[model samples]
Target: MHFTAEQRLDGGVLERTFTLGEIPGILWTPASTSAPVPLILLGHPPLGLRTMYPRLVDRARRAAADGFAAATIELPGSGDRPRWAAAEQARADLRRAVAAGGPVDDHVVDALVLPLVEKSVPEWQAALDALLSLPEIGGPVGYSGGVISIGIRLAVVEPRISAAVLFAGSLVPAVLFEEARRVTVPLHVLLQWDDEGNDRRAALDLFDAFGSEEKTLHATMGGHTGVPQFAGESAARFLARHLK
Candidate 1:
């Protein structure tokens, strides 16, 4: 990992930008700590990291206040990374389907999300490998954020992840249901009840599919981006219980 920039935010939260090979990423931690802190991998939509920086840093600052470090990596085909033709095509197809006012085909959903899940999960694991190597970051990692499928896959396959907070606002391919059943880590899922972009039943079904014996769903009335601040505080509390 090559750190390109570093700054200390208010409240002693240290933010650093870095690159792991081609993947650009950001890490945030308390500037002064006597011992290593647990890490939270902040997952986000395919939107560029720059676009998501404000909210990402907010979560990081909260994690820092709660005595944890937070880090996030750019996803494949996102940010300043090279464009992916196949993913682009899949997105085009999805847009057309949504605009046509028809239920998105399973194949289309598969095309759009599965490959992302396949490609991004390993990248996240790699980031975890690098982030945990830092003396200030320790084990029992928690994952929190969107692109719920990626969170699901990582929870199932990444043993280092002890807990997760998932946002149920994305299309999930049917194939991932089986994978979801394999996820045994504790989970806290946020659902926007009135989200136009999400399938409420499908999100509920996905939550039901998770194999974790401990999982909580916090459903609130709002659009996709309208998650309340209190809801975020609740998620932080959940992560603190498991990761701290």
Candidate 2:
């Protein structure tokens, strides 16, 4: 139950890591705590490439300072101690496959796609379940990620997450959209204006399908990576509004 400090921040940021089920994450919490607070389950990009993404780490620290328990989870196949062999290479291969055929053209990439998806989903679900069980977290939680954000949308249906922040990820295969409709929580999707690969229109279609009246769509100037900084303040505001 003890966590190892991973980083130090200004204004009393304390970083630690916790093993939740089979997954582990670096958590940033404020030094001063008076009571139990809501939690944010931050899903980092695939392959742990963004483990050192400064904006993301800063956001977690700010969330802690703002009085929410925030943690950045290194997904099943994405941490330094990944469960899979050559995890980054495997992820890169899949990305190449997706890019070759376009996001919606699953027929061209299902051979490589299915197994990777299956391998990663369970670990995400376990992380979500563990976060909800923590005394510091309330019923509703906020999720954010790039491509892995799609996986989070798929896994979060049953537990009923309160609010979700999806960045540059899509709900493809139509069936995934059906699952997304089951999420009654507020969903804020951020995408680039000219994202040719992921197709901003696809994200719009998914937003149209969302069941919540509180759903929002914001378009920024840059591609995938641009979202974290563009939407950082908005993300903080959204979490503040809904996580409480």
Predicted structure with the largest lDDT when compared to the true one: 1
Tell me the TM-score of model 1.
0.98
Worst 10 residues of 2 by lDDT: 104-113
Indicate which candidate wins on TM-score.
Answer: 1
The alpha-carbon deviation from the true structure for residue 142 of candidate 1, after best TM-score superposition, in angstroms, is 0.1
Q: What C-alpha lDDT values do all the predictions have?
A: 0.92, 0.63
Question: For model 2, how does the per-residue alpha-carbon lDDT over 61-177 read when each residue is reduced to its tens digit?
Answer: 778867887766665555555466554554566567666774444543343344555665666566667666666655456666545335445535445556777764453545556
Q: What lDDT score goes with residue 242 in model 2? A: 87
For candidate 1, the C-alpha RMSD (Å) to the true structure equals 0.9
Pairs that collide, model 2:
none
TM-score of 2: 0.80
Q: What is the lDDT of candidate 2?
A: 0.63
Please give, for residues 206-234, the per-residue lDDT of candidate 1 as tens digits: 99989999999999889999999999999
Estimate TM-scores for all models: 0.98, 0.80
lDDT of 2 at 217: 81
How big is the positional error of residue 85 in model 2, measured in Å on the Cα after superposition?
6.5
